[model samples]
Target chain A: MLRLILKDILIQKKTLLTAFIYGFFAIYVFGVKYYTNGGFVAGAVAIGYLFITYAVSYDDKNNCHIALNSLPVKRIEVVLAKYLSVVLFGCIGIFTMIIDGFLAELFGFAMPKNYVAINNVLMVFGVLLVMYSIYYPLYFRFGAVKMNIVNVFLFMTIIVLPKALGEFILNHENNPLIKEVLNFIRNSPKSVIQILSFAAVALISLISIGTSTRIYKSKDF
Target chain B: MSNILEIRNLRKQYDKFSLKDISFSLERGYIMGFIGPNGAGKSTTIKLIMNLIKRDSGEIKVFGLDNIKNEKEIKEKIGFVYDENYFYEHLSILEMKRIIAPFYKHWDDGTFKKYIKDFNLPPSRKIKDLSKGMKMKFSLALALSHRAELIIMDEPTSGLDPVFRIEMLEILQSLIQDERVSVFFSTHITTDLEKIADYITFINDGSIVFSRPKDDILESFALIKGGKELLDKDTRKEFLAIKENSFGFEALTDNTDRIKKIFKNEVIIERPTLEDIMVYTVRGEIKCLDSY
Candidate 1:
């Protein structure tokens, strides 16, 4: 099963290279701009989330499921391998962003300190967990083709809703509950929030993995 | 004798077609030709046996083990080749073998190397770069290398040229020398099966039309040709399909002895070929009126 997973990764080496190069540069540019514009933490997390999502999309685009099934491995192994690969890629993406943040800091850019950078990593993990929760079931149920369409629709919603709501709440500045929660989160220690965020992401990832495994085991192909 | 594979009353229903109580058994070391037309439930039945699809109701036992309950153990001993190439486009033949070799406990590297050399497949060549025939040969080589007891192939010879088809059939014939291996090969090309199949199972309209030994199917069934005068209402009833013209009539029947006796003096009784049997049986015509 490890060999199978490695084979899948090796087969897409070219795509991986392209995603890595493009993601590194894109995140670097976003990081630099956000640091200059006073939103470095949010910007890094958002760009990291996008990069990981795109990386996961490569497997869906390639119909790796059918290729994996054709081998002698069990269906459960295939599902678990995919989830593990996603998590592996997520860690790599997060590590890349950390390196990007250090590079930006070295370049005399004004940005959040080390703890905020760590919090940004935690936020990226949370976003990836949410993305997996939404996409994994879609993939197992409808396959890659239909999931692509669904992913696009879901991506739009994820991007637009948070920004729209954030704008509305900030513009009104009159919703006491929203203000209180935001104030609480802002005042919470960075370490505590990071731990809670990582815990939430880990819980979601496990649930998604279980859901995908069950759906995949029952799949016809 | 232990049966290598046994399926009883297997049924699967789709929106357009359904396999109605299909059942057959293949003993160890015997080649079973699963002959069927398009949409005839041949692949469906094979999928059910492989546990690739869920069966509506039936028992599938492979190597004395229940198919669903022992799917992984059964799959370890079985090698399957789909109609289309299953390897990833980017994967070279060697890379594919490298990935697959670990899954089977009995994978023989020497045998795999031998097959690659025998098939003349370039180990470094990507699967997408190979021709259709080369791809099929690669798949066959992979299947044989795993020391599989039962190799299930779906239309493995459909698109190959006559030479390659013959070569492929010969290779399959040689693989069963151990007398411990069996093959269930599905193909519409009857000639492939005619040359090698120990037992033949004919499926039509999503059902098993006939299943028997190759010799029995050929010997018991025949094509009777004669003028319309030979084809009285009584003799015509025995034929599965009949074609009549102004000068003569040709009919197909399952019971060659009975039909020959009925029209012994008038009609000519000739041995039926597998192709003829398939065509006439599928057309669902038994009597011909002498009009044209």
Candidate 2:
């Protein structure tokens, strides 16, 4: 399983440099001008997303699944490796953000303050895990070429859904249900919310791994 | 245990094609040439053996264990080469090897280096930059680097020049001489098989036409030439397929001795090549209809 994850990294080693460049640019733009908290989180999430997509695209472009399946590794191992790679890429993304911050400070460029908080890192991981939980099973079933349109649609939805939901909440601030939900979130213990969020994301990731494995097991190459 | 690979009543179905209970076995230390025309389920059957695809029914056994139950164990002992280069194209040969070597239990770096030197493959070159023949050699080098007991190749020589094709056959010929490694080679190139294959398993339109010793098949199947009148409805039963022209008729018969007895000295009986058997068998019905 480690070998599989390492394989993904090795294949995308060239892209790692581009990820660093993109990370610095995102930090400077989003950190200095726009949303302050979102800069590092957005940079890390984008880097992680880029790594996973590049790894999967290379495999699909080369039809390497046949070679992978022909090896002594189990299909479940392959699926688990992909899931684990999200964590690896997440780490790389975090490291990229920190390095970008250091370079920004060294070069005397303006950047956001306290961008790498524990909450922000946790949020980055949570968002990535949930997004990939939705992407992988579809990728395992339909493959990269067939899933291209679905991927674009999914990216669009992700971009649009948050703003749309925020607008809906703002417009309904006077509603009793909205006020009750807001009160519950405000009154909830921080640790409890953290535990519950972890549990929910972990559950989604586990289910995604299971679905992807089942789909990949019977797949014809 | 004597058979290195075995498929019994194996079946798969697609919208346009299906394999109908195909069965074949390759004993240890022998190269079984799997021959068929294009889209004859040769690659599909190979994929089924490798468990690359799911089979609807029947069992596949490798090294005397159920393929699915022992896939990991079985794959460890099996090395495979496909018609196309499936390795990551952007990665260097050395980098790809780094990824694949850990997957095999008995991967020998020395053996891989030997193949690299012998095949003249530059390890630093990216896979996409290599020519088609070079890519195949790299695949073979990888397949052979591990201490694999069974090597399954699906059309490993399909698109190569004749020189490279012969070289590929020569490599297989030498690999099996150790008497421990067995090879299952699938190809539409019958001539290559005739030169190196010990056993021949022929598949046509997802069905096994025959699986037997190469010499036994060659000796038994005959090509007969005679007058068109000699090919009556009753006499036609002896031939698997027949073709007629202005000179007269030419037919293929598996029962060569019986054909000799029936035709006596009136017809000339000639030995049939593997290509003759495949071409005649696959085109037989259509050719018969065309002649009528």
Candidate 3:
């Protein structure tokens, strides 16, 4: 299983160089423009998550699933390895951003402070776990080809939803249901909000892992 | 338990085709050639045995254990080679082997190194750089180094040159000396099987036509060639298929004894090769008009 995860990383080693360059640029821009975006490391997390797509694309590029199924590993174990690889890529992303930030600071470029940097990495890591919990199952269920189509819709929604939601919130302040939900999130104690977010994401991720494993078990090569 | 692989009523259903009560067994230490034309369910049957695809009905046992229930254990002891390359195209041969080497407990690094040297495969060259035959050599090296008890190859020789095919067959033939390893090789090319396969399992239209020792199949089936006048209903019943042209007609028959009784000293009765049997079964001969 460790070898499987390592294989995913090894194949994408060259991409790590590009990721580092991108991380450095993002961190530099975020530091100069926002100064503090509360866990600006999320920026790097987004870049790192893209590599997971590269890993899966590798699998699809040659129909590796057939070769993988031929191995002695169980189908569930194969799913578990994929989930673990996603986390591994997340770590690689975080590491890349931090290393680039340090290098930039030494060269006298502005960068996020260490404490904020750590906080941002952890925050993005959590976000990744939640997002992948949804994404991995889709990859297993639809496979690489169909998932690319799904990815287009998903990315489009991500690009469009924020502005749309902001407008909806502003226009619907008079609506009782919208007002109540907004009040709950805005007025909740920090600890209560944290606990709710953690619990919801954790629950979803667990379900995602379970679903992915089930889908892979009977998947035809 | 004497057999390394067994399938009993193993069936899979697709919208257009379904395997019907397929059954065959390959004893330990012999190669069984799985012969069929395109879409004859040869690869489908192999896929079911590997549990790559689920079977709609029937049972498959590998090394005396249920193929699905003992999938990991069975796969540990089995090495599979697909028709085309399945490993990552960008990674070098060594990197690909690294990914597979750890899964099998009995994997031998020394043996693998030996094969890489013997096959002259550069460890650093990416899989995409290698020729089709070279890729197959890499596959075989991986399959062999793991102490596999059975090697299941699906059309491994289909696209390779004859020279490499013969070399590959030599490697398979060498493995048979172990007396514990078996090979289940499927191919449309019967000549490849004729050279090395001890047993032959013929499948057509998603069903088993016959499974017997290679020698027995040759002995049982014969080709009869004579004029079109020998086309009575009783005489035609003995033929699996009959082909006719300007030079009289030729027919295939498994009932060599029965046909001999009817066409004795009149028609040429000659031994049929695996190709002849395969072609006769797949391409039924052109029928003669019912001219009594």
Quote the true-contact fraction of every model: 0.28, 0.93, 0.80
* Candidate 2 local Cα displacement, residue A32, angstroms: 1.2
Tens digits of per-residue lDDT for model 3, A165-196: 99999999999999998899899997887788
Tens digits of per-residue lDDT, candidate 2, B41-152, equal: 9989989998889999999999999999999999998989999999999999999999999988899999999999988999999999999989999999999988999999
Candidate 2: lDDT of B135? Answer: 94
Error of 3 at B99 (Å): 1.6
Q: Give the TM-score of candidate 2.
A: 0.95
Please say which candidate is ahead in TM-score: 1 or 2: 2
Put down candidate 2 lDDT per residue, A1-221, tens digits, no spaces. 89999999999898899999998888777786784868788789888988988899999998999999999988989999999999889889999998988898789876667777899889878888888899999999988888877776776576467779889999999899999987887899989889999999999999999899999998888
Model 3 fnat value: 0.80
Best by DockQ: 2
TM-score of each: 0.87, 0.95, 0.93
Off by over 4 Å in 1: A36-67, A95-118, A153-169, A183-199, B285-292
- lDDT tens digits, residues B36-125, model 1? 778788888887887777788989999999988877788888888778765666778987788778878899999989989988999999
CAPRI docking class of candidate 3: medium
Q: Please identify which of the two predictions, 1 or 3, would achieve the higher TM-score against the true structure.
A: 3
lDDT of 1 by residue, A5-54 (tens): 57555655565455445444644564445533213333443444454455
